[model samples]
Target: MAKYKAPLRDMRFVLNEVFEADKLWAAMPATQEVTPDLVDAILEEGAKVTENELFPLNRTGDEEGCQFSDGDVTTPAGFKDAYNLMAESGWMGLGGNPEMGGQGMPKMLTVLFEEMLYSANASFALYPALNSGAALCLDNHADEAMKEQLLPAMYEGRWLGTMCLTEPHSGTDLGLIRTKAEPNADGSYKVSGTKIFITGGEHDLCDNIIHLVLAKLPDAPAGSRGISLFMVPKFLINEDGSLGERNPAFCGSIEHKMGIKGSATCVMNFDGAQGWMIGEPNKGLACMFTMMNYERLSIGIQGLGLGEVAYQSAMDFAQERIQSRAPGGAKYPEKAADNILVHPDVRRMALNVRAFNEAGRAFASYVAMQLDTSKYHEDEATRKKAAALVALLTPVAKSYLTDRGLDCTITAQQIYGGQGYIREWGAEQYVRDARIAQIYEGTNGIQALDLMGRKVVSNNGEYLKLFAQDIQDFIESNSDNAAVQPYLEKLGASLETLMQVTGNVITRAKDNPAEVGAASQNYLDLFGLVTYAYLWARMVAVAAPKAEADTSGFYSAKVKVANYFFARILPEAAALAAQVNAGADTLMDLEEELFYGE
Candidate 1:
């Protein structure tokens, strides 16, 4: 396996330089206490933990997988100690509410650390990732007493958290779930159901496992309207804040999976498990959505982190593995043959991965910045605008990042040739791990539909206009910068194309609802491509001037990647535009019965 190293320089460049996160932090009251030195220390220590602790366990965990006997699940060796180290260091609650025991770090900084965790060991990362999501849900919906009791222990790492939503019969359709929640004599309720694919469902790493489960009450209406969220713990908590006897919830079995083997995906049986209602009755879906949104972004980061690791490993291999001589001449004449880096095809693969990874980093940071603004901005109008932007881009961030992440991982694996397929190199693991990101968190297709249906069509293109206007504003501001003029023009053209496509989709959907579904995936891709273009332009605007004056080549590399993205990658927006414009005729004309002939 290739040794994992955190990409701190690129991360710092995105955080401190590209986004000017420090300035944003200083301006926000919530983040004013987050000093530059504190951010640096967090990143440095996070890097050490991921590289030294988690990376060592990644391959071994994959090989060993998890062991389940009876209702208990045991994680792979080294996971317990590493998890403890992470929790003891307060990494689990980096973004938790400060009023609780959390460090209260901003998402902009925590996101960088999250990428490192995902890069080091995706399986190990899932544990804390789920905890963070659960914590966010509780912070938002749980009552003060519930918060006072649960948040502190979870933030302090004495407990871990899980989100239990998926059941055997239902995946994307939460309304189809069969979990049952019944009121007891006390205020607490009894939750009973079988939930599958529950990550960290029954792990042994912490003292207690808190499950934020979704179920329906007896008096509730049918379908999604009836669902309610509950907080079910593995060990019932006493009023004195101490652990009591084990609850009825048990892991019937653990799954055997393609990747992330160290993370226990289990079949949890909540046999009349004692649980407390989180929000109001029959509002469980809404409560769970708060966590789902958080998880969706986190899962997207899972792809980004794995992609970075794959790129690093591939780049390292290309520099050392000698193959056929260069097309022009032998670059390493003294050696038997030139390195693979001398080939255009090899460079193409590397650059493609680099382009996507770097853009993904920027895009994630942008979303994080919006999250910070929405939460901390003093002006109500500013907060509403930030919140709108977050809603508009959350689906894009989740779908586009994961889609490109999977592509980058595959390209990176191809760089290894036959060696990439082998387990020793760890290239294939990246591919396997990345595949889930696309499928889970409502799938890329679902994200596309949501983007088109709810965010765009339902709003009558209001959110789309807001995003386009932001891009136009940036283009106008940089119109005179000779260094970024070409980029500005390309971005401007793409933004116009996106606007036209959005209007077309809205008009067509009015006549035929299927048109929305047909154009969704392609339309989402177009939006994503243009968004990346805008970000690349911003990055180039920052780096190009510095590159021209310096010989260090750091800023020059940024310009090169930006150029490659515009020249090679951004043109895909045109093809996507063509596809979306093709309409739903071809898709709908094909009879459903023909899909599977008798």
Candidate 2:
């Protein structure tokens, strides 16, 4: 595989140019202290850590995987040292609250850093990624005493965090979780149950592992409402912030997964583990979601990151591997055969990966910007709007980015021909690593359902309308610019199609609930396509004028990718709309038992 280099230029382009991140940061009081120089320094250092410490482990970690014995889990060689370096260097707390010993950087900035982390080593990245998400949950829902006791150490990397939601039987349906939390006289509860698929549940990298587990109280209501959140640590903490005896939470076993093998996916056996309740009783699902929302976006970045590494590897291979002659005769006539880069098909694959990676970066940053705004805007109305956009786009960011990440990885593998399938090339590892992003953090299918049912249908498409209005407003303002006219027109048409399809889904879903499930996936794809079109249109508007006068061709490349997206990718929205309009009859008409075919 090619050497992993952080795409600093494109990251800068998206943050400083496409999104004007500095200006947005300046407007928010919470981010006002963040200067452009500080942001650049952070990005540069983040790149260094990921490239130097994490990138080298990508292959080795996958090869060695993790070791498990008894109740102990051990990471691959060099992983412990690399993790310590990451934590000691303060990368883990880049987005943590400042008052709690964190840098409290804006999400807009950290999202880029996160992309770099995932691109370098996804398995290793999961360690701190879970910590960040866990910290966010505690910061929001945990009591003041809990935060004071845990937040500082967690931010400083003395401890790590994990989220335990899934069980052997309860996967997507949290209402069926059988974990039991019995209240004790000391105000803490004993959390007892077996939680499966818990990432970083028991690792040697940190002294203590804090688990945000979901369970039910003795007299709690039934179903999801009965579920409550708990903070179960691997080792109990004393009043002086010292570690006490080991807690009952034990890693019973680990799963042999297809990808991300270095990260311990444990089956945690909580044998009456002493735990503290977070938020109110029977509201554990809500608290868990507070972290899950953060994690969903992080997992999406996993997709974007893996796609980037795969694309770089593919581009490297295409430029060096000599194959058949070019269509218009050999570009390198002196050589026996020209490199595969000379072929249009190779270019199409490369360009497709590039197009999605760049757009995904911009889209993720845009969402991060909204996140910063929602948290620190100071104005109630602005915060509400930003929060709504975050809700509407979170599913898109998680699902579309992973779907495209998988597509890009497969395309990258295709560029290597037969060599791609071999483990020696490292290309296959990327494919395996990226596949889980779509499955976890709520499967891409679940994301579509959430997008259609909760975020859209439940609100009567109010957020969707707000989003469409933003696109329409952008089109009207830039309609006169000839360079971006085509993109604007295409985006406008796609927006209209999205609106029409959304109305159809809402109308059909009212009578038959199955319609939401049937149309959801396609509806999400359409929403994602049109959303990308809007961002690409904005990107082209910024790049066109610069391309006209620049000799570097930097801006020209941006314009070319934007053009490719509009012409080739944006058209997917039309087909998705048609599929969504096909309604539930085609899907629900078939008998359930017949699905197996006699």
List runs of model 2 lying over 4 Å from the truth: none
Tens-digit lDDT string for candidate 1 (237-282):
9999999998999999998888889999999999999999999999
Please report how far candidate 1 places residue 497 from its true position, in Å.
0.7
Off by over 4 Å in 1: none
After the best TM-score superposition of candidate 1, give how far the Cα of residue 159 lies from its true spot, in angstroms: 0.4
Alpha-carbon RMSD, each predicted model: 0.9, 0.9
Query: Model 1 — TM-score against the truth?
Result: 0.99
Instruction: List, residue by residue over 1-598, the lDDT tens digit for candidate 2.
Output: 6468999998998899988988988888889999999989998999999999999988999999999998899999999999899889988789998988889999999999999999999999998899999999999999999999999999999999999999999999999999999989999999999999999999899899999999999898989989999999999999999999999999999999899999999999999999999999889888888889999999999999999999999888888899989998979999989999999998899999999999899989989988999999989999999999999999999999999999999999999999899998889999999999999879999999999999999899999988888899999999789999988889899999999999999998899999999989999988988888999888899999899898988999999999898888888888899999999998988888999958
